[model samples]
Target: MSIVWYYDFISPFAWLQWPKIKALAAEHPITLRPILLAGILDLCGQKGPAEIPAKREFTYRYTLWRARQAGVTLNFPPSHPFNPLAALRLCIAAGSSGAATEAIFDWIWGHGRAGDSIEALAPVAAALGIDDPVAAIADPAVKAQLRENFDAAVAEGVFGVPTLSIDGRLFWGDDAHEFALACLRDPSLWNEPEMQRVAALPIGAARQA
Candidate 1:
C-alpha cells in the first residue's frame, strides 16, 4: 500500500493536508508517492478551486480554519495556478539522485510554490542538493522521466489531490487519511465485506452523512 499524493502546487486543501499526511506516513511505514496535481487537472479538465465563485471564497476560509487545526502554515499560491512541470521535474530529479523525494514534497506543500522564481527555489534546491534540476528538467531524459511519472499516475486511475492507493483501491482527501493509514498498516481493515462500503465514506461521515 502506498500514499499517492496527487496535489497541485496551488491547491489550498492539498496544502492544508500536507503536515498530517507526512506525520501519518512517518508513524506508519507507508510509502509516499508524490504525483503532479497538474496531471490530475489535465485529466479532469478542471482548474484550481479559486476559479469557482462561491467555492473559491468558501474554500479559502475553510482551508485556513483547517490549517489552523492541522497546525500547518501556508501562503495562498499566486493568482494563477503555478506550473507543476518544473516542480515535477525537481521531484523526479530528487528521487533519481537518491534523495528523499517525499521530504522535498513536504517542503513544497508546506511552504514552496511553483510560482516562485528559480531564485526562490534555489535554497530548497541547494538544501536538497539538486543543483542540476533546472538543467535536468530541461533535458530530454529527465523530461521523459517526468512524463512517465504523470502517465503512471493517470494509469492508476488517480483523479484528485491527496488520493491514497492501497492495493488497487483509492481513497481521497485529508479527511480520509485515517482510513488510508488503517488500510495501509493492516489489510484487515479492508478484509471484510462491509468494510468495502464503510471505507468509501469520509472520515466521521458515518455519523455526519
Candidate 2:
C-alpha cells in the first residue's frame, strides 16, 4: 500500500513528524504532497490555533516540548506567520524529494530562519544545487503547480499538515503516526464495517435518525 502525506513547511508539527515519516517511508511507499497551509485554513474557514492569542503561546511551547520528546530539532522562525510560498515553490521545482522537503523544513523550523524572502531562500537553493531559484519560483508553470497541489488537497478533505491518507481513510497530525503504521500493516482496518458506519455519522449530530 501507499500513503499520501500532505504537508507545509511552516508547520512545526509537520517538522516534528518529519523524522518519523522519513523512517516510516522505508517500510511503506509514501508520496509527498505539498500544499499551502494558509490556503487550507482559508478554505476551511478555520483559524489556526496559533492564530488565537491564548493558544499561540501554548502551541509554541507544546511544539517545543514535543520536539524534545521526539528528539527532533525545532526552532520557530524569526517571526510568526511568514510566507513560505517561495520555499514551497522551490520544493515543487525540486520534485518533492523527501531530502529536499526536509532540508527546507529544517532550515525554517530547525534553524529558525525567516524564510519569507527570496534572499533568505537563496542559500537553501544553492545548497540544493538548484539554479536560479528566484526564477524558478517566478516560473508560471511552478506557480500553477503549487496552486494545483493546494486545490487537490482541499478537494481531498485535507485540513492540516502531516495528514496520512489511503483509500479515503485519514490519519491526521503527528500523534497519529503509529496508528497510521498500524493501518498500513492491516489494510482491512481501512474498511471495518463498524468503523465505516461510525464514519457515516452526521457532523454535529451524535445519532442519525
Listed in order, each prediction's TM-score against the native is: 0.74, 0.91
Candidate 1 lDDT (Cα, whole model)?
0.63
Candidate 1 Cα deviation (angstroms), residue 59: 1.7
Candidate 1 clashes: the total is: 0
lDDT of 1 by residue, 93-175 (tens): 66633244444445555554444444556566777776765675577876777667577668888777767676667777878
Give one digit per residue, the lDDT tens place, for model 2 in 1-209: 54788888878888888888889888778888888898889877789877998899999999999988888888899988778788888888888888789778878998998778778988888888888988878989988988888887777799888798775578889999888878878988867999799989778856443
Q: State the local distance difference test value for candidate 2.
A: 0.84
Model 2 regions lying over 4 Å from their true place: 203-209
Q: After superposition, how far is residue 165 of candidate 1 from its true place, in Å?
A: 1.0
Clashing pairs in 2: none
**Model 2: how far residue 30 lies from native, Å:** 1.4
Each candidate: what lDDT?
0.63, 0.84
